[model samples]
Target: MVADAMELATRALLEANLGLAEQVITGDERIDDARSACEEQAYALLALQAPVATDLRTVLAAIHAAESLERMGDLALHVAKAARRRHPAPVLPEPVNRYFAEMGRVAVQLARRAEEVIRSQDVAAARAIEDADDEMDDLHRHLFTLIMNKEWEHGVASAVDVTLLGRFYERYADHAVSVAKRVVFVVTGRMPGTVSDDDL
Candidate 1:
């Protein structure tokens, strides 16, 4: 769902297609529905199954991951709306379009890795997702540099659009990384960097 939304939102920006933007906005409803269903089922299991320890962690992690994924979808929808708001005026100017395009591709990659880590609980893949998120963060910083530089020609409106676009991608990557971390926690009975007094 995040992948599809990212693709549509990217296309809307690149093509300046209001229709695609609207499609992305409307498509988010289904993603929301899917997330709600997942959460509902997780809660139902918690209520009825009386799961403990590993099972409890699994359910909690699932709920957390689903929530993160839904937020990622919302960020994609925001990107689409930005494109729609600036319709006929390019949201992303030509020079900076490649950076956003690359961000979209990396978002899709991280989202896919997030799903893989969720299903397989592979710690190595979860770490890889975190590394991919670093790339997204670097791209986001580069975007800020471009817009903040005095040579920027697109002016305030374009600057606002670019700023929002970079944030959407950055936040989407954040949620993906969160999902990956939740997967690690579910598998290992611990978060990546935290420790209890006993471990200390």
Candidate 2:
């Protein structure tokens, strides 16, 4: 659902498709609900069972991952609102639109990867998401440079939109990284940076 929101937000921005933007805006509540359900279920499981070792880790990871995913959904919602606010005028202009589209694609990819890691608990795949986040960071820096460039003609408003939009995408990727790291913790019995898998 978070991935879908990111994709729709991108499509809405790139195509100036008002309907898609509306869908993203309206559908955010469903994401919130789903996130709530995940947290509630995880809590219920913890309350009912004295889970040991891997089981305890799995439940805890679910709670953390659900929170991260909810944050991702909120970031996507921000982008959709930005698109809707600037409808018909185009929130992104020309070449900058291409950069945002790339950002969008990477964000959606991260969200999907986070989902997969949560389900499969693949530590290798979780590490891959950490690497993927670097691309998002680079793209975010490029957005800042784009606005600072003297040749920029989109004016202050579009520049502001671009900055906020870039941040939204970058933060979405950050949350995905958090989710992946939680999966790593579940599998390795330690967070990614605290201890190496070989040491554990």
Candidate 3:
């Protein structure tokens, strides 16, 4: 169920990036519903089955993971709105568009990695997910530099729009990393050290 929820969130993000504004908003409801259901199931399992130690950790991690994925869905919607606001005019230049696409791809990969770690209980895969998130952060910083430098120079509104879009994409990837960290916590019971202190 957790895996399914993650997949749905990833799909919602992809749709948002593809310029389906209405669908992205509508899909957020489903993501919220799924998160609620997952929370209920986790609580029920704790109440009825009395999971202990590792089992308890698994349930708690699942709840956190669902929450993170839900936030990712919301961020994706925000990105869609920004995209819509800049409609008919390309906010991102070709190079920035390429970067945005790469960021989206990395976000999806992180989501899938989280799913795999959860389903397989593989701590190593979770670590790899964490490492991949570092790359996303680097790309995010690069995108920011491009926007701030007025690389596209579409004027103030377009620059702001692209900046916000880059921020949303970066945030989406961060949430995915959060899910991966939760997976690692579930398996190993330790929070990993930060790769860097940058907000992205």
As for candidate 3, its clashing pairs are none
The order of the candidates by lDDT, greatest first, is 2, 1, 3
Question: Least accurate stretch of 10 residues (summed lDDT) in model 2?
Answer: 191-200
The global Cα lDDT (0 to 1) of model 1 is 0.86
Query: Compared with the true structure, what per-residue lDDT tens digits does model 2 show for residues 56-157?
Result: 999988888888888888988898898899887678978898898899999999999988988888999999998998898888888788899999998898
Once superposed on the true structure, which residue ranges of model 1 sit more than 4 Å away at CA? 192-200
Tens-digit lDDT track of model 1 for 88-110: 88888899999998999999889
TM-score of each: 0.93, 0.93, 0.82
User: Model 3 compared with the native: what TM-score?
Assistant: 0.82
| Per-candidate alpha-carbon RMSD to the true structure | 4.4, 4.3, 3.9
lDDT of 1 at 72: 86
| Candidate 2 colliding pairs | none
